[model samples]
Each structure stands twice: as structure tokens, then as C-alpha cells.
Target: EGYGLTEASPVTHCNPIYGRRKPCIGIPLPDTEARIVDLETGEKELPVGEIGELAVRGPQVMSGYWNMPEETEMVLKPDGWLLTGDIAKMDEDGYFYIVDRKKEMILSGGYNIYPREIEEVLYAHPKVKEVAAVGVPDEYKGEVPKVFIVLKEGETATEEEIIAYCRENLAKYKVPKYVEFRKELPKTMVGKILRRVLAEEERKKMAEAG
Candidate 1:
């Protein structure tokens, strides 16, 4: 249950991710519904068991974008539906789970790397304090997953050990191809991880090192 933007007016869909945190965002408050669709084709209205971009077309849907006609046309189709650029999947029980932001999908050797999947595994490790997974350039794969980690105070873990741990938990393709440790992580006033900024900084460092 985040802020309701123009695309999804009045905020109709949500999932209960956290417990005891400001009512319930997960379960729909009633009189609201949602759906999932394949972004590439937009033909398959995937079943609840599949993962796809979340699209909602109801009374709460937005009319159109502010001004940009092309941008508005790209999102709002002739069928009167707004394609929210959020990736999500619905459960058999009818609740929807937001996977990642649309633009955040990292393409690595034909694989889609979602940072949340990798970050979830990293967070489960006892020594890992905070982690952000990003895609870095790779000659063969086009791009590869890289993990930026911050350890808990008074704890220390080598990059190899961390990588090994991830290997044990994730698929070989899902495991981070690169690992970097830092004392503290950069954060904004609201404390959401700024991944794009970190990825850019890492690319800059690589350029300087070269």
C-alpha cells in the first residue's frame, strides 16, 4: 500500500508484505481488483500462478498522461487500459506480489536479473548487514550481477565467503558474479537504497581503474 499515483488512481491493489505495519497493504480493502499481463506481447493475461507486469483496468484507472501524447499513447492503449510499469504476480488466493520496478530488470546473457531475489538471499545470511545487487558489463554475458555488501558492526566476512554463501543459496546464474564490501551504504533521507547511483559509481571506478 504505497502512494497512489496518476496511473493507478485511488490505489486499489496491494499485498501484505510486512506485519503490523500501518493496517494492511497486501489484502485489498474490498471493491477493488487487479490483473497481471505479459509486457512484451500484452496478449497473455497470465494466470495467478505466473509472474508478469501488473495491469489494472477499473473505475480507478487514470484517464491519460499529463500532456505528452506519445508517452500517453504508449502507456494508455486504445482499449482503455493503463500499463503500470511494475512487475508483479498474483497468488492463487488472489493477492498480488510486486517483484521489481520495470526498468530495474537486468539483462545478463539472456537472463533477467532481479535484484530483490538476490538481495533477499544475501539478507538471510547472518553476517550480511545490507546488500544491493546490480548488473555490470560482461564480455560474454553482456551484463552480470554484482553485489555491494555492508557487514554488521563488529562482524567481518571475506568476499569469497559471501560469494560461496550465495552460491549455496541461489542458482549459479542468480548468484552474484562480483562482490564488493564497504563499511557503510549510501542512503537517502527516506532510506531506500539508491541502486542506480551505486551502479554508476562502480562503472566510473572501473573506467578510472582501466
Candidate 2:
């Protein structure tokens, strides 16, 4: 699949008709330049295979948002690069892979954890029908991963079983610290899982508990 945004005239990168890598967004289109930059400052370009925010510049990119200078300036650099707010990396072959959205990243104990990485592992579990991994507030770690899951029909699973599965598949820092079984996960009208909503709920719950 390709990657683009409304700010970029909606099309930037795509897998070539041939030599396309599965699950990769492919290379930049002709005249479109894309780079992975340091997430903290968005200045230093990151090396290949390193995950960072994606920035792009091309003929198709927008000049500015209509009458929204502050918002426009936040994303559009004077040098013509548009910050995509997407975590991504490029391979040696020049194929671009989207890791996840920057806002949804979980900062747990100094490790950068992407919910998609955790969800992918949980999805592989035989009993898991759907899952959403989100960062919840943690006093000691600043934040930690907590997963909400919907089990497959007639399937049974325990929090310990799920945690053990993650412990086996993921690094210690990346494994979710909490598991909550649910009848269904919240979703957008288009059926995309609402991870932000889950995260907000978690924060609210922690606030109430304290």
C-alpha cells in the first residue's frame, strides 16, 4: 500500500508494480523526496533502518493550511518539508515502512514502544480476535502498555496466559503490563480501532483511582 496525506495532495509513495515489498509503503514517487528525521527536533535526518518521523517535500505538497498560520507552521517547514506525524523507516532498497503514528507511541521506561508491534504479537495468539495496545499512566515508568482484547468466539484466555504469550514474543520492556478482556473494542465508523479513545479512558481511570 502507498502512503500520503491531505497536506501532501494525498499521494506520495507507493509500491512499484514490480519489486514491491509486502507490508511496505514503497519508494517515493518521481520528484517526491522523503526522509526519516529525528523525532525530538525533526532536524537531523536518521540513518536507514532507524525509526523516526517521516518528512516529505515534493511538487504535490501544500504551501500552507488555509488561514491557519500557527497550525501550518507546526507541520510545514520553511525548507518545504512537510512533517507527516508518522513514525517510519526506510530500508537499504529504499522501500519505506510505516511503523505507527507518532502520537500513539508509548514511552515506557525509556523505551519507545509502538502499539502496532504489540498488537501484531497479540493477534497471533489463537484466542485473540482483536486487540488494542495503549499506554497507560505509570508512576514509576511514566507510562506502560495495557492491552484490551476481544477473544475469538468460544475461546477462553486468562490475563496470565496473554502476558506469558507476550513475554515469550516481545522484549521485557515492550511486553504489555496489563491485559483486559472485552466484549468488543471501540472503533470508528469506518471500523478502525480507536486507540486514542482507549488511552484517554485509561488516563481518566487512573486519575479517578488516585
Candidate 3:
């Protein structure tokens, strides 16, 4: 596994040929230094196993986007660390696990909910084949998390049953307000789920209803 962004000029982290961990993006590459910084402040580094933004400093890292100073300042810190929008946690063994995306975090009822966290819970259901969770605008809470799911072949489940499964494994505030069944979740060419597409669809549906 490797971790990198366009601004980073490509690969930054990858598991060594000799050692690898499942679900880990791997250790920082040579000449690269990585840290998990607080999501809100983006200043203080968090301890091991704590989830936060993954920041990296290396020669391979880009100086800034061409001619986009304001946007550059948002991600490129003066101290030389590039703030990757990915939220992640590093274990003691130095392996990194991506939790979610900072911009994708849902703020609902004064709670910060990571869609990946809910997706993780939902994916464990025997009937679930695929799922994508997104934040939808809610009149009372500003935004509430909702999920779209695709069931496994020959499996079936009710909305209440799925919600109850999540409730058992997740905090109350983290529970999705709406559950939708889809023939299939949207995906990118590489087979990555496109949660933003679902979120935008929900917004349009709400607008049409209004």
C-alpha cells in the first residue's frame, strides 16, 4: 500500500517488501516525515493511534499549485508540511490507516461524523454488499448522515434492521438518519465509491421536493 497526492508528486508512503499490514497504506518513504495533526487546528500532532489529518514533508512534495497562492496556503504550511486532506491514524509499528477525508466529515447536531466509520459498520452486515454514506442537509441539524446500500446476492434486509445494526455498533449521533437501497453504489473507474455523487443527488432530491 502507498499514500500520495498530486501535490506530492506521487508516492509518499508504502509498505516495505518484507513487512506489510492489511488495510494499511504503509510507512513513510525515504526522506519523508509524516505526522498526524489535529483536524481543527492543524497545528498540534496527535499521539500514536489517534486519528487526525496526515501531514507530510519531503523533497518529493510540490512547492505549491501553479499560481494558486490562496489555495496553496490552505494546504502547504510555511513549515514545509503538506496537509493531506485525508484523516488517518498511525499505529506504533508505523503503519498508517486512513479513516476518512477531512472535507467529507459531516457536522450534524453539533456532532462530527465520519462517513467511513458508519460505512465500516454497515459493511459488516451479512446482507450488505456495498455501501456509501454521505451528509444530507437537514432543516433541524444543518446536516444529517444518510447511507445508500446494495445488498449481497440473494440477501435481504429492512431499513429498520440495517439502522438497528448500526445502532448496536455506533454512537447515537453517528447513526444515519436515512437508509436507501440502491441497485449498486456509484463508483469510480478504479472501483472507489463516490460518496460526493450520492450527496449531490440527495441535495437535488431535497430541492425538488421543496
Candidate 4:
């Protein structure tokens, strides 16, 4: 419905009351400027349809975090733009769509993979109630996607079946190499899945096994 962060007074973009596109965050509000920038440096402004970090500058944007100049400086650019740390793209119509978080992106075999893309495919499976795709340590590829799925009540599915389904819908590199079925996923009070927590758990498991 809307897109923003606490640093931006919590609201920056919202869908129009009418003619709003599904899953799009809509155009920037009055006096607010938003752009897609290079994910690496967050400096080069990307062209439309290019996936990059979303940055915003407006009156509602926060000046700085309380007594945390270093933390503030990391996000707030010298020119006043605040990097939202979200991987996003803008359509020709100016509607913005979030692909995923920059930090959550998986780099496997030199290919960039967004977890949301994988999660969306799994969510379409009738037996899957919820799913999260996270990058786990991989010796050959540096990192590979591993999916954690929560099956619908009274439904049963196997890892092989899920993998086969993904293989049909996704590229070879984007297909998850491992799967873990869970009763429920770690979530925030607002119901956002905690991919970072899952990723940390995988890292710990690798360390323990080694």
C-alpha cells in the first residue's frame, strides 16, 4: 500500500486511492524525490526498469539519528538522499516495485539472485503456506539459495517435489539447492519474515559442522 522507513517520517510513497497498481508502491509524494541508484556505490542513478537501491530526498526525511552520526552518515548521503537499502525498480509509468533487500541478495556462481523471486514461486504451490529463501554458504558458488517452507495445514510435500517444481519455473542458478520444512518461520511482530535470522542460523550450522 505504501513504502517508507522510520527515517522518512515513516511514509514516502503510497498508492493512489484509485487506479493504483497491485504490488506497486506508487509514485513519490509531492516534494519527495526518489530514484534508483547503483547498488554497489549508491551514486550512479540507474535508468528506468533497472533494479537498484532506492534513494529518497524530501522534507519528511530525517536529518540524522540521535547521537549516532556514524550510523546516520552511512545511510544519509552528503546531498541529503537517504539510501533505503531496498532493491527496487521503477516502471515507465513511474510506479516503483520492490524486488528485495540489497543485503539479502544471493550471489551464486556469479549470478545475482533475489530471494523474493524464489519465494514467490514457492508461495504459488498449493501445499506451501509460507516460504523464505535464504543464501547459505556454498564452497563452489560462494553462496547458494536454500528455501525454508511452511506447508499448509493438513498438507504434505517433499523436498524433491518442491525442487522439481522450482526447476520447472526458475533458472538453474536460481533454483534452490536445499530445502527445510518448518512449522513456522521466524517473524517480526508485524509479520515480516526474518530472513537474516534464518541466514545466521545456517552460518552457525556450518561453523558447528566444520
Candidate 5:
């Protein structure tokens, strides 16, 4: 049960007690109209169950980003729709699911890969305590998913083992090409994984290697 933004007066949605999906952001709050639009254009509304950028309109939304007109215009449309950067989809029942951050999606061999989908598969493994999937540069594919995992206490796993497990659970292109074992992951005070920090580190290492 969650949905919020600095520009949306905070919460725009919440899961109800009777009908709710576990880990979902839930349905749009009262008076808030939500829609999923094309990720590239942000104009065409997508059909149900189709993943796209989430947009919302309501009284709670901010007028503009405090004189940052250009920045405000990018997200806050003239028609009162706020084009949220989050990738999401709506179910037939009207529940909303956050796919991942729009920028976090991977473009590999012309296929769109969502990091959250891969992370979900990794989380199913018994030894995994935490995991973050980031796109790394791949000469042939443009980019490939690289997973960094933190193992649970007293647990041990190998790169081959983890990759093999993923291969069995995910499509070939969606399988991570690289697996890194980390003692701990960078995070915010509230425990949100800092994936951008991990992406930066991967780029730095690749640059140095090149």
C-alpha cells in the first residue's frame, strides 16, 4: 500500500483492506485519476496490464516546481496530468503495480528488461539476502543486466551457481551476465537500495578496464 511524490502532495494511492495485492502501490486515492502512458512519448495511454509511465491528476498535485518552470513542464502537463517517472501498470481489478524506475530498464539486444523482474527471481533463492540489478555496458547488446547480491548470514554461493539458477528461472536474454557478491549494499537511511551508486561504480570499473 503506497504511492507518493514530492509534487503530488505525497500519497496519491493506498491499498484497501478488502481488495489488495501484496507489495502493490494499490489503487488511486479518492479523486485521483491515474493512467499508464507510453514510456517514450508519455502521451498515449496504454491498455490495462501494459507497463508504462504512470501519470496522475488530482487536487493534491502541485501547481509547479517552485519557479523551475522548464523542469516542472516536463512532468506536470498542461492538462493537469503529472507524468510520474515511475514505470507501472494497472490490473483489470484497478490495482496498480510499480514495475521499476523508468531509467532503470535495460536495453539488451533490442529487448527491454526490467531490473525488478530479475531481482524478483534472485530473491526466490534461499541464500540471497539482498540483490540489486543494474545494466552494464555490453558491446554486442548495448547493455546487459549485472546483478550484485548480498548473501544471508552463514550462507554461501558461487557465481556459477547463481547464474545457473537464474538461467532456469528466467529467459536467456533476461539472465544476468555478471554476478557480484557484496558484503553489503549502499542504501538510504530508510533502506532504499542506491542502485544509481552501483551503476556508477560499474561504469567506473568498465572505463578503467577499457
Candidate 6:
């Protein structure tokens, strides 16, 4: 996923998944450079595998954050790093991993939950043809992982079975609290599953029930 920064300049990260594997943004392109900064102090680099705001500085980096000088100054550090608002981390293999869409990381009971992990487990089920995981508001846990699934043709896996599998493969905090079976997934033209769309539908149903 090549994220565009206005004109699509400046850095951060890019994801190029060639298959069903959890894709990583590979090394920089020609003349492009990037770094991961601690989300708090914005100084120093976290070891590979730690998540943080991705910053970049290279020929392709934008000059500023548009006309928002204050915002620009805040993002484009005096040291020439353009703090792309995206959150990510690099791997030991020098590949970048996006944590969330800045807006999508779920803060539930003081824990930051990323959806990709749960989605990965769901993908492991042979019966699951497709799935999407999203966060829904929860008054108790603050938020919870909810999964919407599309099973493979003639295949069967109950919602409880799916949750049990997740509990086996994931942390207690990471297992989805809700599950839904779908006939077909809402997808982008390019075939990307849109979790946000399913989340909206889940919200509508929850609202109706109330």
C-alpha cells in the first residue's frame, strides 16, 4: 500500500504484499530514506519490532505539511525528518510493518490492540474464505475485537469454534469477543477487505438492538 502524502511525497512506509502473507514494506526506493521514532519524545530509534511513528527524510520527502506551518513544524522536525503521521515498525529483516491507520488502533482498557493479528488467525481456518477484524466500542473493556467472516464454499466453522481457535492462538486480550458470518465480504475494487465497512454494519445492528 503506497500511501500518498498530498502529492505522495515524503516518507513513512509502503506495503507491497505479493500474496496472502502478512506483507511488509520493503526497503526504501532510490534516494528515499526513513526512520521509526519513539511516539512520545519523537527522538531516538526503537529497536526493530517496536512500533512508533514513521519519519522520513530523503529527496522524495515533502518540504512541509502543506500550508499548516505549525503542523508542518511539528511533523517535519528541525532535523529534517518528516514525521509521517503513520505508525509502524521495521523488522529484523529490514521490512516495515504498519501497526494501524493512526485512527484504527483500538484502545481498550488501556491496551492498544491491532486488528491484523486476529485477522491472521482467522485466515488460518481452512473453512474461512475471507474475514475482517475491527474494533467496536465497549463500555467495560473500552473496546473489543469483532470479526466478520466469509467461509469457504460448503465449509463450516461455528462462531464459537472460531473464538476458541483464537483463544488458543492469541492472547486473552487479542481474542475477538464478537463474531459474525457473512455471505460475502465487502471489498475494494482491488479486492481488499474493508473492515471499516463491516464495522459500520455491526454498529447499525447493535443500535437496532438497543
Q: Model 6 compared with the native: what TM-score?
A: 0.78
Q: Which digits, one per residue and each the tens of the lDDT, describe model 3 over residues 133-162?
A: 999999999999899999999988889998
lDDT of 1 by residue, 74-182 (tens): 7776776667787877776666677887767778888787889999999999998899888887889988899899999889898889889989999889888889998
Task: Return whichever of 1 and 4 wins on TM-score.
Answer: 4
lDDT of 4 by residue, 52-71 (tens): 99999999999999999999
TM-score list, all predictions: 0.85, 0.96, 0.93, 0.94, 0.93, 0.78
Between prediction 3 and prediction 6, the one with superior TM-score is 3
Cα lDDT computed for each candidate against the true fold = 0.77, 0.94, 0.91, 0.94, 0.94, 0.77
Q: Identify the candidate with maximal TM-score.
A: 2
Worst 10 contiguous positions by lDDT, candidate 3: 15-24
Error of 5 at 183 (Å): 0.8
Task: Name the candidate, 1 or 6, with the larger lDDT value.
Answer: 1
Pairs clashing within candidate 1: 15-26, 16-26
Kindly give the stretch of ten consecutive residues in candidate 6 with the minimal lDDT sum: 12-21
Quote the lDDT for 204 in model 5: 99
Which pairs clash inside model 5? none
- Give the clashing residue pairs of candidate 2, or none: none
Model 4 misplaced stretches (Cα beyond 4 Å)? 18-22
Ranking by lDDT: 4, 2, 5, 3, 1, 6
How many Å off is the CA of 91 in candidate 3?
A: 1.6
Model 1, runs deviating above 4 Å: 1-3, 14-33, 205-210
| Cα lDDT for residue 206, candidate 2 | 80
lDDT of 2 by residue, 9-103 (tens): 78999988876566788899999999999999898999999999999999999999999999999999999999999999999888899999999
Alpha-carbon shift of residue 31 in model 4 (angstroms): 0.5
Candidate 5 at residue 108, lDDT? Answer: 98
